[model samples]
Target: MVRVATLLLLRHGRTTANADGGLAGRQPVELDETGRAQATAVGERLRSVPLAAVVTSPLIRCRQTLDLALPQAEPVVAEGLIECGYGSWEGQPLKKLAKEPLWPVVQQHPSAAVFPEGESMAAMSARAVAAVRAWDARITAEHGPEAVWLACSHGDVIKAIVADALGVHLDLFQRIVVDPASVTAIRYTPLRPFLVRLNDTGGDLSGLVPPPRKRRRRAARTTDSDAAVGGGAGAAR
Candidate 1:
Protein backbone atom coordinates (compact mmCIF):
# COMPACT_ATOMS: atom_id res chain seq x y z
CA MET A 1 0.00 0.00 0.00
CA VAL A 2 1.30 3.45 -0.88
CA ARG A 3 2.00 5.62 2.15
CA VAL A 4 -0.72 8.22 2.02
CA ALA A 5 -0.13 11.76 3.22
CA THR A 6 -3.24 13.81 2.97
CA LEU A 7 -2.94 17.56 3.43
CA LEU A 8 -6.08 19.60 3.92
CA LEU A 9 -5.32 23.26 3.19
CA LEU A 10 -7.66 25.88 4.64
CA ARG A 11 -7.71 29.56 3.82
CA HIS A 12 -8.74 31.85 6.61
CA GLY A 13 -12.07 33.66 6.77
CA ARG A 14 -12.64 37.11 5.34
CA THR A 15 -11.50 40.39 6.88
CA THR A 16 -11.53 44.10 6.07
CA ALA A 17 -8.23 43.49 4.29
CA ASN A 18 -9.75 41.08 1.80
CA ALA A 19 -12.79 43.28 1.08
CA ASP A 20 -11.14 46.66 1.47
CA GLY A 21 -8.09 46.14 -0.80
CA GLY A 22 -5.76 46.33 2.18
CA LEU A 23 -2.95 44.00 3.19
CA ALA A 24 -3.86 42.23 6.42
CA GLY A 25 -0.76 40.02 6.47
CA ARG A 26 0.52 39.51 10.00
CA GLN A 27 -1.73 42.28 11.26
CA PRO A 28 -3.21 40.08 13.98
CA VAL A 29 -6.75 40.60 12.73
CA GLU A 30 -9.46 38.18 13.83
CA LEU A 31 -12.18 36.81 11.63
CA ASP A 32 -14.61 39.57 10.72
CA GLU A 33 -18.40 39.05 10.84
CA THR A 34 -18.54 37.52 7.39
CA GLY A 35 -15.26 35.83 8.17
CA ARG A 36 -16.87 34.18 11.16
CA ALA A 37 -19.70 32.86 9.00
CA GLN A 38 -17.24 31.57 6.46
CA ALA A 39 -15.19 29.95 9.20
CA THR A 40 -18.28 28.46 10.78
CA ALA A 41 -19.38 27.03 7.48
CA VAL A 42 -15.96 25.52 6.99
CA GLY A 43 -16.06 24.10 10.49
CA GLU A 44 -19.38 22.45 9.76
CA ARG A 45 -17.97 21.00 6.59
CA LEU A 46 -14.96 19.52 8.37
CA ARG A 47 -16.76 18.72 11.58
CA SER A 48 -16.87 15.01 11.13
CA VAL A 49 -13.61 14.21 9.40
CA PRO A 50 -11.03 12.31 11.43
CA LEU A 51 -8.10 14.67 11.34
CA ALA A 52 -4.72 13.32 12.50
CA ALA A 53 -3.15 16.70 13.19
CA VAL A 54 -3.91 20.36 12.59
CA VAL A 55 -1.07 22.63 11.46
CA THR A 56 -1.63 26.37 11.49
CA SER A 57 -0.06 29.77 11.08
CA PRO A 58 0.48 31.83 14.20
CA LEU A 59 -1.32 34.86 12.79
CA ILE A 60 -4.62 35.55 14.46
CA ARG A 61 -6.60 35.35 11.23
CA CYS A 62 -5.43 31.87 10.36
CA ARG A 63 -5.45 30.81 14.01
CA GLN A 64 -9.00 32.09 14.32
CA THR A 65 -10.00 30.36 11.13
CA LEU A 66 -8.63 27.10 12.52
CA ASP A 67 -10.35 27.76 15.82
CA LEU A 68 -13.69 27.96 14.08
CA ALA A 69 -13.00 25.14 11.63
CA LEU A 70 -11.86 22.82 14.37
CA PRO A 71 -13.78 23.83 17.47
CA GLN A 72 -12.51 20.74 19.25
CA ALA A 73 -9.32 20.62 17.17
CA GLU A 74 -5.84 21.17 18.46
CA PRO A 75 -3.13 22.52 16.14
CA VAL A 76 0.65 22.78 16.12
CA VAL A 77 2.01 26.22 15.44
CA ALA A 78 4.28 26.31 12.40
CA GLU A 79 5.81 29.69 11.82
CA GLY A 80 6.89 28.43 8.44
CA LEU A 81 3.21 28.12 7.62
CA ILE A 82 2.68 31.82 8.27
CA GLU A 83 1.46 34.25 5.59
CA CYS A 84 3.59 36.31 3.23
CA GLY A 85 5.02 39.63 4.35
CA TYR A 86 4.68 42.48 1.82
CA GLY A 87 7.23 44.67 3.61
CA SER A 88 6.29 48.26 2.81
CA TRP A 89 3.37 46.96 0.82
CA GLU A 90 1.81 45.23 3.82
CA GLY A 91 -1.17 47.53 3.91
CA GLN A 92 -1.03 48.97 0.39
CA PRO A 93 -3.88 48.44 -2.04
CA LEU A 94 -3.36 45.99 -4.88
CA LYS A 95 -4.84 48.47 -7.30
CA LYS A 96 -1.94 50.79 -6.63
CA LEU A 97 0.68 48.04 -6.90
CA ALA A 98 -0.69 47.07 -10.29
CA LYS A 99 0.99 50.15 -11.65
CA GLU A 100 4.39 48.57 -11.03
CA PRO A 101 5.41 45.79 -13.39
CA LEU A 102 7.28 44.02 -10.61
CA TRP A 103 3.91 43.20 -9.10
CA PRO A 104 3.16 40.80 -11.91
CA VAL A 105 6.58 39.23 -11.64
CA VAL A 106 6.17 38.68 -7.94
CA GLN A 107 2.87 36.97 -8.55
CA GLN A 108 4.25 34.81 -11.31
CA HIS A 109 7.54 33.92 -9.62
CA PRO A 110 6.36 33.71 -6.08
CA SER A 111 8.60 30.72 -5.44
CA ALA A 112 11.58 32.82 -6.39
CA ALA A 113 10.51 36.44 -6.04
CA VAL A 114 9.28 38.85 -3.41
CA PHE A 115 8.55 42.52 -2.81
CA PRO A 116 10.97 44.96 -1.27
CA GLU A 117 11.28 44.73 2.52
CA GLY A 118 10.13 41.10 2.48
CA GLU A 119 11.39 37.57 2.22
CA SER A 120 12.20 36.11 -1.19
CA MET A 121 10.14 33.55 -3.06
CA ALA A 122 12.85 30.92 -2.75
CA ALA A 123 12.87 31.44 1.00
CA MET A 124 9.12 31.08 1.17
CA SER A 125 9.27 27.85 -0.78
CA ALA A 126 12.04 26.43 1.39
CA ARG A 127 10.33 27.18 4.67
CA ALA A 128 7.06 25.73 3.48
CA VAL A 129 8.78 22.66 2.12
CA ALA A 130 10.57 22.09 5.39
CA ALA A 131 7.40 22.38 7.41
CA VAL A 132 5.53 19.95 5.18
CA ARG A 133 8.34 17.41 5.16
CA ALA A 134 8.58 17.62 8.90
CA TRP A 135 4.88 17.01 9.19
CA ASP A 136 5.03 14.05 6.86
CA ALA A 137 7.93 12.47 8.73
CA ARG A 138 6.31 12.91 12.10
CA ILE A 139 2.98 11.57 10.94
CA THR A 140 4.54 8.59 9.22
CA ALA A 141 6.39 7.67 12.38
CA GLU A 142 3.47 8.37 14.67
CA HIS A 143 0.58 6.91 12.67
CA GLY A 144 0.94 3.60 10.95
CA PRO A 145 -1.51 4.45 8.16
CA GLU A 146 -4.75 6.23 7.31
CA ALA A 147 -3.63 9.45 8.94
CA VAL A 148 -4.23 12.85 7.33
CA TRP A 149 -2.27 16.01 8.05
CA LEU A 150 -4.55 19.03 8.13
CA ALA A 151 -3.11 22.52 7.92
CA CYS A 152 -4.97 25.79 8.27
CA SER A 153 -3.07 28.60 6.59
CA HIS A 154 -3.26 31.64 4.39
CA GLY A 155 -3.61 31.49 0.58
CA ASP A 156 -0.02 32.00 -0.46
CA VAL A 157 1.43 29.59 2.08
CA ILE A 158 -1.04 26.94 1.06
CA LYS A 159 -0.21 27.54 -2.58
CA ALA A 160 3.43 27.11 -1.80
CA ILE A 161 2.60 24.01 0.16
CA VAL A 162 0.86 22.59 -2.89
CA ALA A 163 3.72 23.53 -5.13
CA ASP A 164 6.26 21.90 -2.84
CA ALA A 165 4.22 18.74 -2.55
CA LEU A 166 4.03 18.48 -6.33
CA GLY A 167 7.70 19.46 -6.68
CA VAL A 168 6.84 22.26 -9.08
CA HIS A 169 7.55 25.94 -9.53
CA LEU A 170 5.62 29.07 -8.73
CA ASP A 171 3.80 28.97 -12.06
CA LEU A 172 1.76 26.17 -10.58
CA PHE A 173 0.38 28.77 -8.22
CA GLN A 174 -1.58 30.17 -11.15
CA ARG A 175 -3.36 26.86 -11.64
CA ILE A 176 -4.38 26.79 -7.96
CA VAL A 177 -7.00 29.28 -6.79
CA VAL A 178 -7.68 29.10 -3.03
CA ASP A 179 -10.45 31.36 -1.82
CA PRO A 180 -11.11 32.48 1.72
CA ALA A 181 -12.39 29.58 3.83
CA SER A 182 -11.79 27.29 0.88
CA VAL A 183 -10.17 23.89 1.22
CA THR A 184 -7.70 22.09 -1.02
CA ALA A 185 -6.74 18.49 -0.47
CA ILE A 186 -3.70 16.50 -1.56
CA ARG A 187 -3.27 12.75 -1.19
CA TYR A 188 0.37 11.82 -0.87
CA THR A 189 2.15 8.53 -1.33
CA PRO A 190 5.47 7.58 0.10
CA LEU A 191 6.85 7.81 -3.41
CA ARG A 192 5.03 10.88 -4.71
CA PRO A 193 2.16 13.30 -4.22
CA PHE A 194 -1.06 13.61 -6.14
CA LEU A 195 -3.61 16.38 -6.16
CA VAL A 196 -6.78 15.03 -4.67
CA ARG A 197 -8.52 18.37 -4.99
CA LEU A 198 -8.06 22.08 -5.57
CA ASN A 199 -9.53 25.39 -4.52
CA ASP A 200 -13.00 24.60 -3.34
CA THR A 201 -15.83 25.91 -1.29
CA GLY A 202 -17.76 23.30 0.69
CA GLY A 203 -18.42 21.89 -2.75
CA ASP A 204 -14.80 20.93 -3.41
CA LEU A 205 -14.85 19.00 -0.17
CA SER A 206 -16.78 16.37 -2.13
CA GLY A 207 -15.84 17.50 -5.64
CA LEU A 208 -19.12 19.35 -5.80
CA VAL A 209 -18.06 22.94 -5.47
CA PRO A 210 -21.23 24.51 -6.68
CA PRO A 211 -21.07 26.86 -9.63
CA PRO A 212 -20.99 30.56 -9.01
CA ARG A 213 -24.35 31.92 -7.95
CA LYS A 214 -24.27 34.80 -10.45
CA ARG A 215 -22.01 36.74 -12.73
CA ARG A 216 -20.49 39.05 -10.20
CA ARG A 217 -18.83 42.17 -11.45
CA ARG A 218 -15.17 42.19 -10.51
CA ALA A 219 -12.88 45.07 -9.62
CA ALA A 220 -10.91 45.77 -12.75
CA ARG A 221 -8.01 47.03 -10.67
CA THR A 222 -7.77 44.12 -8.25
CA THR A 223 -7.73 41.08 -10.45
CA ASP A 224 -5.24 39.23 -8.22
CA SER A 225 -5.54 40.85 -4.87
CA ASP A 226 -6.19 37.87 -2.63
CA ALA A 227 -4.81 35.55 -5.25
CA ALA A 228 -1.74 37.72 -5.21
CA VAL A 229 -0.59 37.80 -1.63
CA GLY A 230 0.96 40.98 -0.32
CA GLY A 231 1.91 39.45 3.01
CA GLY A 232 2.74 35.92 4.22
CA ALA A 233 6.28 35.90 2.97
CA GLY A 234 8.58 35.53 5.94
CA ALA A 235 8.46 34.09 9.46
CA ALA A 236 6.88 36.48 11.97
CA ARG A 237 9.24 39.48 11.97
Candidate 2:
Protein backbone atom coordinates (compact mmCIF):
# COMPACT_ATOMS: atom_id res chain seq x y z
CA MET A 1 0.00 0.00 0.00
CA VAL A 2 1.20 3.49 -0.73
CA ARG A 3 2.23 5.26 2.43
CA VAL A 4 0.13 8.29 3.24
CA ALA A 5 -0.86 10.21 6.36
CA THR A 6 -3.16 13.01 7.36
CA LEU A 7 -1.71 15.71 9.56
CA LEU A 8 -3.96 17.92 11.63
CA LEU A 9 -2.33 21.20 12.56
CA LEU A 10 -4.03 22.81 15.52
CA ARG A 11 -3.18 26.23 16.82
CA HIS A 12 -3.11 26.37 20.57
CA GLY A 13 -5.94 28.03 22.42
CA ARG A 14 -5.92 31.76 23.01
CA THR A 15 -3.63 33.26 25.63
CA THR A 16 -3.54 36.53 27.58
CA ALA A 17 -1.21 37.85 24.92
CA ASN A 18 -3.71 36.97 22.21
CA ALA A 19 -6.47 38.87 23.89
CA ASP A 20 -4.22 41.78 24.81
CA GLY A 21 -2.77 42.06 21.30
CA GLY A 22 0.74 41.28 22.53
CA LEU A 23 3.22 38.70 21.30
CA ALA A 24 3.71 35.81 23.70
CA GLY A 25 6.66 34.36 21.79
CA ARG A 26 8.29 31.56 23.80
CA GLN A 27 6.81 32.61 27.11
CA PRO A 28 4.90 30.10 29.20
CA VAL A 29 1.54 31.72 28.73
CA GLU A 30 -1.48 29.92 30.12
CA LEU A 31 -4.77 29.77 28.30
CA ASP A 32 -7.28 32.42 29.18
CA GLU A 33 -10.80 31.45 30.28
CA THR A 34 -12.08 31.82 26.76
CA GLY A 35 -9.09 29.88 25.56
CA ARG A 36 -9.98 27.02 27.85
CA ALA A 37 -13.50 27.06 26.50
CA GLN A 38 -12.17 26.97 22.99
CA ALA A 39 -10.05 23.96 23.80
CA THR A 40 -13.05 22.11 25.18
CA ALA A 41 -15.05 22.91 22.09
CA VAL A 42 -12.31 21.63 19.77
CA GLY A 43 -12.03 18.52 21.93
CA GLU A 44 -15.67 17.76 21.33
CA ARG A 45 -15.08 18.17 17.62
CA LEU A 46 -12.12 15.77 17.58
CA ARG A 47 -13.55 13.23 19.99
CA SER A 48 -14.89 11.05 17.20
CA VAL A 49 -11.69 10.80 15.15
CA PRO A 50 -9.15 8.09 15.92
CA LEU A 51 -5.74 9.69 16.03
CA ALA A 52 -2.50 7.72 15.76
CA ALA A 53 -0.40 10.33 17.53
CA VAL A 54 -0.75 13.67 19.22
CA VAL A 55 2.19 16.08 19.30
CA THR A 56 2.50 19.50 20.85
CA SER A 57 4.89 22.37 21.09
CA PRO A 58 6.77 22.83 24.36
CA LEU A 59 4.91 26.01 25.13
CA ILE A 60 2.55 25.95 28.11
CA ARG A 61 -0.35 27.30 26.10
CA CYS A 62 -0.09 24.38 23.69
CA ARG A 63 0.25 21.85 26.49
CA GLN A 64 -2.77 23.24 28.30
CA THR A 65 -4.83 23.21 25.13
CA LEU A 66 -3.98 19.61 24.39
CA ASP A 67 -4.56 18.56 27.99
CA LEU A 68 -8.09 19.86 27.74
CA ALA A 69 -8.75 18.77 24.16
CA LEU A 70 -7.36 15.23 24.18
CA PRO A 71 -7.24 14.36 27.81
CA GLN A 72 -6.84 10.66 27.16
CA ALA A 73 -4.00 10.96 24.65
CA GLU A 74 -0.35 11.30 25.55
CA PRO A 75 1.31 14.11 23.61
CA VAL A 76 4.96 14.25 22.65
CA VAL A 77 6.50 17.65 23.20
CA ALA A 78 8.55 18.84 20.21
CA GLU A 79 10.97 21.70 20.60
CA GLY A 80 10.99 22.28 16.85
CA LEU A 81 7.26 22.94 17.06
CA ILE A 82 7.66 25.57 19.74
CA GLU A 83 6.71 29.19 19.13
CA CYS A 84 9.22 31.35 17.27
CA GLY A 85 11.67 32.92 19.64
CA TYR A 86 10.37 36.47 19.48
CA GLY A 87 13.26 37.55 21.67
CA SER A 88 12.92 41.21 22.64
CA TRP A 89 9.61 41.33 20.82
CA GLU A 90 8.08 38.91 23.31
CA GLY A 91 5.15 40.39 25.20
CA GLN A 92 5.22 43.55 23.14
CA PRO A 93 1.91 44.97 21.99
CA LEU A 94 1.18 44.42 18.31
CA LYS A 95 0.32 48.08 17.87
CA LYS A 96 3.74 49.10 19.12
CA LEU A 97 5.51 46.42 17.14
CA ALA A 98 3.73 47.59 14.05
CA LYS A 99 5.55 50.91 14.29
CA GLU A 100 9.03 49.38 14.50
CA PRO A 101 11.31 49.27 11.43
CA LEU A 102 11.36 45.49 11.35
CA TRP A 103 7.61 45.30 11.60
CA PRO A 104 7.08 46.18 7.95
CA VAL A 105 9.73 43.70 6.99
CA VAL A 106 7.97 41.00 8.95
CA GLN A 107 4.73 41.96 7.26
CA GLN A 108 5.97 42.20 3.73
CA HIS A 109 8.97 39.92 3.72
CA PRO A 110 8.84 37.55 6.67
CA SER A 111 11.51 35.31 5.17
CA ALA A 112 14.00 38.09 5.82
CA ALA A 113 12.72 39.13 9.23
CA VAL A 114 14.73 38.09 12.24
CA PHE A 115 13.79 38.50 15.86
CA PRO A 116 16.34 40.34 17.91
CA GLU A 117 18.12 37.83 20.15
CA GLY A 118 15.82 35.15 18.79
CA GLU A 119 15.17 33.20 15.58
CA SER A 120 14.45 34.22 12.04
CA MET A 121 11.08 33.72 10.38
CA ALA A 122 12.76 31.63 7.68
CA ALA A 123 14.38 29.41 10.30
CA MET A 124 11.08 29.00 12.13
CA SER A 125 9.37 27.96 8.89
CA ALA A 126 12.09 25.48 8.04
CA ARG A 127 12.03 23.79 11.45
CA ALA A 128 8.27 23.72 11.85
CA VAL A 129 7.82 22.17 8.41
CA ALA A 130 10.52 19.59 9.08
CA ALA A 131 9.08 18.67 12.48
CA VAL A 132 5.53 18.03 11.27
CA ARG A 133 6.65 16.19 8.14
CA ALA A 134 8.93 13.96 10.22
CA TRP A 135 6.15 13.21 12.65
CA ASP A 136 3.77 12.45 9.78
CA ALA A 137 6.19 10.00 8.19
CA ARG A 138 6.83 8.25 11.48
CA ILE A 139 3.13 8.02 12.32
CA THR A 140 2.22 6.67 8.87
CA ALA A 141 4.96 4.07 9.06
CA GLU A 142 3.91 2.90 12.50
CA HIS A 143 0.15 3.14 12.16
CA GLY A 144 -0.26 2.29 8.49
CA PRO A 145 -1.10 4.58 5.62
CA GLU A 146 -4.48 5.37 7.13
CA ALA A 147 -2.89 7.11 10.09
CA VAL A 148 -4.10 10.52 11.17
CA TRP A 149 -2.12 12.63 13.61
CA LEU A 150 -2.32 16.03 15.21
CA ALA A 151 0.23 18.63 16.20
CA CYS A 152 -0.66 21.53 18.43
CA SER A 153 1.45 24.65 18.00
CA HIS A 154 1.54 28.43 18.05
CA GLY A 155 -0.16 30.74 15.52
CA ASP A 156 2.80 32.00 13.55
CA VAL A 157 4.41 28.58 13.46
CA ILE A 158 1.26 26.93 12.21
CA LYS A 159 0.75 29.64 9.61
CA ALA A 160 4.28 29.23 8.37
CA ILE A 161 3.88 25.49 8.06
CA VAL A 162 0.65 25.92 6.17
CA ALA A 163 2.33 28.38 3.85
CA ASP A 164 5.01 25.84 3.04
CA ALA A 165 2.47 23.09 2.46
CA LEU A 166 0.50 25.37 0.17
CA GLY A 167 3.69 26.23 -1.73
CA VAL A 168 3.29 29.84 -0.79
CA HIS A 169 6.33 31.91 0.01
CA LEU A 170 7.32 32.61 3.60
CA ASP A 171 6.89 36.30 2.85
CA LEU A 172 3.18 35.73 2.22
CA PHE A 173 2.57 33.66 5.30
CA GLN A 174 1.13 36.69 7.01
CA ARG A 175 -1.91 36.35 4.78
CA ILE A 176 -2.90 33.12 6.42
CA VAL A 177 -4.87 33.51 9.61
CA VAL A 178 -4.81 30.57 11.98
CA ASP A 179 -7.22 31.38 14.75
CA PRO A 180 -6.73 30.04 18.26
CA ALA A 181 -7.87 26.39 18.44
CA SER A 182 -8.51 26.16 14.71
CA VAL A 183 -7.54 22.96 12.91
CA THR A 184 -6.01 22.65 9.45
CA ALA A 185 -5.76 19.27 7.74
CA ILE A 186 -3.16 18.14 5.25
CA ARG A 187 -2.89 14.70 3.68
CA TYR A 188 0.50 13.75 2.34
CA THR A 189 1.05 11.35 -0.51
CA PRO A 190 4.18 10.38 -2.43
CA LEU A 191 3.44 12.91 -5.14
CA ARG A 192 2.23 15.89 -3.17
CA PRO A 193 0.47 17.14 -0.06
CA PHE A 194 -3.20 18.04 -0.24
CA LEU A 195 -4.59 20.86 1.89
CA VAL A 196 -7.84 19.17 2.86
CA ARG A 197 -8.90 21.93 5.19
CA LEU A 198 -7.73 25.34 6.29
CA ASN A 199 -8.24 27.38 9.41
CA ASP A 200 -11.35 25.46 10.35
CA THR A 201 -12.77 26.83 13.60
CA GLY A 202 -16.40 25.74 13.27
CA GLY A 203 -15.43 22.37 14.74
CA ASP A 204 -17.07 20.39 11.96
CA LEU A 205 -14.61 17.58 11.30
CA SER A 206 -16.90 15.03 9.70
CA GLY A 207 -15.07 15.28 6.40
CA LEU A 208 -11.85 13.98 7.90
CA VAL A 209 -13.43 10.68 8.84
CA PRO A 210 -12.57 7.92 6.44
CA PRO A 211 -15.31 6.43 4.32
CA PRO A 212 -16.51 2.88 4.86
CA ARG A 213 -13.88 0.33 3.87
CA LYS A 214 -15.85 -0.79 0.83
CA ARG A 215 -16.38 2.75 -0.32
CA ARG A 216 -12.75 3.56 0.29
CA ARG A 217 -11.76 0.63 -1.89
CA ARG A 218 -13.86 1.96 -4.72
CA ALA A 219 -12.47 5.44 -4.25
CA ALA A 220 -8.95 4.08 -4.29
CA ARG A 221 -9.13 3.66 -8.08
CA THR A 222 -8.40 7.35 -8.19
CA THR A 223 -5.73 8.49 -5.83
CA ASP A 224 -7.10 10.60 -3.00
CA SER A 225 -4.02 12.74 -3.39
CA ASP A 226 -5.26 14.02 -6.71
CA ALA A 227 -7.39 17.12 -6.52
CA ALA A 228 -10.83 16.43 -7.88
CA VAL A 229 -11.67 18.37 -10.97
CA GLY A 230 -14.69 20.70 -10.51
CA GLY A 231 -14.00 20.53 -6.78
CA GLY A 232 -15.44 17.00 -6.86
CA ALA A 233 -18.45 16.15 -4.79
CA GLY A 234 -16.51 16.86 -1.60
CA ALA A 235 -16.40 14.30 1.26
CA ALA A 236 -19.27 11.90 1.07
CA ARG A 237 -22.14 13.12 3.12
Best by lDDT: 2
RMSD of each: 13.5, 2.1
Candidate 1 stretches with Cα past 4 Å from truth are 204-237
Query: What's each prediction's clash count?
Result: 8, 0
Q: Who wins the TM-score comparison?
A: 2
lDDT of 1: 0.72
TM-score of predicted structure 1: 0.80
Worst window of 10 by summed lDDT in candidate 1: 206-215
157-193: candidate 2 lDDT, tens digit per residue: 9899888888899999999999999999998777778
lDDT of each: 0.72, 0.88
Model 1 C-alpha lDDT per residue in residues 76-189, reported as the tens digit of each score: 898888887767777778888877777777766655567688777677767876887778678756864456667888887888778766678776675767889988887556
